[model samples]
Target: MSSRSNISQYQGLLERIVLCFLSTGPACFFLLINGILMFSLRSKPVFRYTCRYILLYNLLVADTAQLIVTQVLFLLAVGRVKITYAVCGTITTMANLTAGISPLTLVIMTLERYVAVCYPLRHASIVNIKNTVVAIIAAWAVSTLNNVTRNLFLIEYPYEKFGKVLMKDYCTNIGWIPDSLCDDYDRAYNAVVFVSASITVISSYTGVVIAAKAASTDKASALKARKTLLLHLVQLFLSLAYTLYYPLLSALAKTVQRIVFVWVQNVIYVLFIVLPRCLTSLIYGLRDQTVRPVLLHYLFCRWKLSVEPATC
Candidate 1:
């Protein structure tokens, strides 16, 4: 491409930078409020004891991590400076690992809800605190193994004339291999993660719907089932965006076109990852009436005003 073409290609980068800044400001604001809410409710008995609450809390934590990672890396990318390999490797590994695991954790939570609504008799025994903790541990383990294995194979030194540097900045899976092997591996990984989540979601929803049909007379159960389905649907769409963006990245290689791609990717991350987190607190507020009273009580009590709660 000519110099003019290069300039045109990178034109989108400026627009993206503006959008990222706009999105980041709100994301940070949401994170601040969400963090306060999470901490305030941390000790509450309902949040402490419920399996669903634990899952939701984990999701929020993971999303918060995503927000932090993306914002910091994004700033660096925009500045266009050199990044050492060590920092890049670790950040890349952690970001991808955590982000990938979160959706799978959501899948597990969906299954748990399915069992609760579809097979109430087994819900208590199947999804108690102990089992819930074990499930979370298993999820972390699986996600760690996937990232570590993939990174280990991909990250190695290039001898005099033997191998070449496999990846570029920030643990991103970039290589100069003219072969399709790496692509195949990526496709396989995507397939496994996507297929697993899809199957779990389909089965869980099918079970819920079937159970809802049979128990239509129970209005409360039906309503709970519908709410659960809606939440899962939102999560599925967000995750699908996650699964799709990576494959389409290459098509945006023109310098100017990449600007739009970069911003779109960041915006998508906010919508899919960060919004779910902010929505968690909101969802709790809307779905559980008890949360509102407790939250309001925490915010304001009948005690006489003193120096100020900020000091305390």
Candidate 2:
């Protein structure tokens, strides 16, 4: 659908190889850290039963799935490997599902923090093991529903146009669907999801700030909650900004030299798409006191963390 890659075809073979190598280095490293953090979350009973930790585990799982799917798509685009609609649909659907789930999970995490800060006395009862589990399930269920609806619209498209056998170009979500409704649905869904998530985070942050001022409140805990919410807001913003991936490149291609356009596209992928997925693990792994030592121990390859020369 995008004859936009006419400039990309002019890129040198050796140059594409180097670009892939450079991007893969950071992608692999982020995936490694994410794996360690995930293992740390399950290696002990503390994480398994705690409400916030359980929520963290769910969020990490979504982010990891998101990272893997996007990376696979990126590799395909880089190699210019065109495939059948069946393959592209499966991969892009997974990408679309994960992309939506991450923001929703982040919203859940934000609300959990808000409860802890603003309603400390009732936090445990309101956000217990059962409810947190239910929240995570609802996030995934909603995202799956969205994916199914979009695919229905996709199936409704008059495939006689492209013949439905093989995609004419490298796969991206917007490229496969030629319908105006699909584009409009995409814009509307993305706007609603991101905007709602952003508002939720901001409201939670505001609640934490207000609670911090009460004489009955614990200022320390509320302060920490504020900072954490801020980080989540930053992450969400980066995710929302990435919706411009195709249009941004298309505009640049028309104005810049081909070589410069290709290089800028590569850098933008790393900055927006690749980097935000890594932030969730880094932020919570290092920021939370309870998870830090265990995360670091596994991150550096040790089974047990030691402080007394033998054990903590």
Candidate 3:
């Protein structure tokens, strides 16, 4: 290889390292705030019946998972391992689990919102503590099952070519097990999961917008509902787009794609997963009166100042 090529590769590696630093730090901060919010609300009885609390809890959990896995694994890659296929595979699976489950939770949350706003009378009976726990358990269960089933489809294979040559470092000789046996099965399963989750989220939120418009007797209530749905729609778009891109890039290219894919993956981790958790409390705090008061109470306490009368 030429010196120029070596320089370029080194530069790219440096860029990835910088990107990891920029991404992971902010991601961790967001995850920390999310943890605080989740724990704080756990003891609040008023928020127990609301969909916001449930959705917030799920969002925090998924983003926290993403931050921990990505941050630690990337650090490990930098400090210890040389980024082997096995290491990369494990990271990819964990990242996918965090990324994939996020959107699914969004779908469920939007559906929960739809039911609450559309059918206010039945919201209480349907969205109780018992049902919310069940729903959360089911989401985690389904996500785990999906990851296990998909990872099984990928098999590592060794390659040799031109008789008497072991091609360990070359690109062409090193290969996956079989396209027919593994690629199609994995792609089909993942596509189904991604498409189904995206459609479900979008459709449920669309229904939410409609129901909000129809049910709101006042303009202010309708506007508030619209704003919340809009924010969720943006999140849904970001998640779905990345979920589609990651698999597409992996399937199409073999080498040189890592530069683009790795960076893009980091971007999604920041934008879709991390940014939401950091900004969610702020978003709700700035927009909603109820959230603002709760946040203020937590942050700024108005303790009574006792003083003796001044005797001059």
Candidate 4:
């Protein structure tokens, strides 16, 4: 029994160490990459005005907020720290607000791509910088309102037998709210958003593909259109994976051992949330033809300066 107990304790410690790295490492890297992208876009007027870069910038901001919240929760869990009801509630609300905004933003991005690809002649008027900025603000406002309303029902001060606020692994809706309500809300929210967004993305991408195929007279333009829509589909799929992550994590928690549950949860969080957010910088920002050249040029200049001998 003693040996088994020691083994279990060590295993838990190992899990915590791994979870800390998984949570913080990607977040820091994402912040760095996003900073570079933001600076590059802001410094270049051409990229700043482009609808695609504007949408991507908003997405990066949303993802960074989500990552910061997630990392804080991970730190609390690893340290076994209990927080006040208000603090926990505030963190949970912020996390939900950011989480809600991410998918909505992605949906808007897909719609923007649809307009740009399917209605090339009107794309400028329809998806300009001004319209993109307004859409981003609307997405943030709607998501914030929805999450704030839902969080109002959260039970922030749930207590144990000794009349102390119960500590939890993370500040989450499921941890703070009644199980039934949490289940119902999650199901309703996921069903409505996931189904609606999936339909919009699929339909829009289909239109884009069809439009690209029909415009075979400009073969290069048609090919570029198809490729751009394909990237959008990839991004949509990643966002869908993130949407489904919570329900899957809940299911696993009920069935798995304590150690197994923590391990799986951390892995799921990193893979579905962190990894996809990092990939967005690569797929949507850096690899973009217009942005790539600017990024490369900036990096090359910085590199050249570091290597050149100092002037006498």
Give the higher-lDDT candidate: 1 or 4: 4
What TM-score does model 1 achieve against the real structure? 0.76
lDDT of 1 by residue, 45-67 (tens): 67777787777677767766766
Residue-level lDDT for 289 in candidate 2: 84
lDDT of 4 by residue, 1-312 (tens): 999999999987887887888778877987787777776666665666677767777887877777788778768866577775567767877877777776788888888767766777787888877888898999889887777667656545344431345545555556655557666776787678778877887888678777766744355665665676677667766765666676787899789897788778788888887777677778766667677766665655553211111110
User: CA lDDT of 287 in candidate 2?
Assistant: 89
Per-model tally of clashing residue pairs? 4, 0, 0, 0
- Candidate 1: segments with Cα more than 4 A from true spot: 1-20, 159-180, 215-217, 246-249, 255-281, 292-312
Task: Return the lDDT, model 4, position 113.
Answer: 69
lDDT of 2 at 28: 91
RMSD per candidate (Å) reads: 6.6, 5.0, 8.6, 5.9
lDDT of 2 by residue, 49-141 (tens): 788888888878888888898888888887879987778888889988888877888899899999989998888789888898899999999
Q: Candidate 2: which stretches are off by over 4 Å?
A: 1-11, 158-164, 306-312
By descending TM-score, how would the candidates be arranged? Answer: 2, 4, 1, 3
- Give the top-scoring candidate (TM-score): 2
Can you list the residue pairs that collide in candidate 1?
Answer: 9-255, 9-256, 10-255, 10-256
lDDT of 1 at 36: 53
Instruction: Kindly report which residue pairs in candidate 4 clash with one another.
Output: none
- Judged by whole-model lDDT over C-alpha atoms, candidate 1 comes out at 0.64
Residue 79 in candidate 4, Cα distance off native in Å: 2.6
* Best prediction by lDDT: 2
**Residue 254 of model 2, lDDT score:** 94
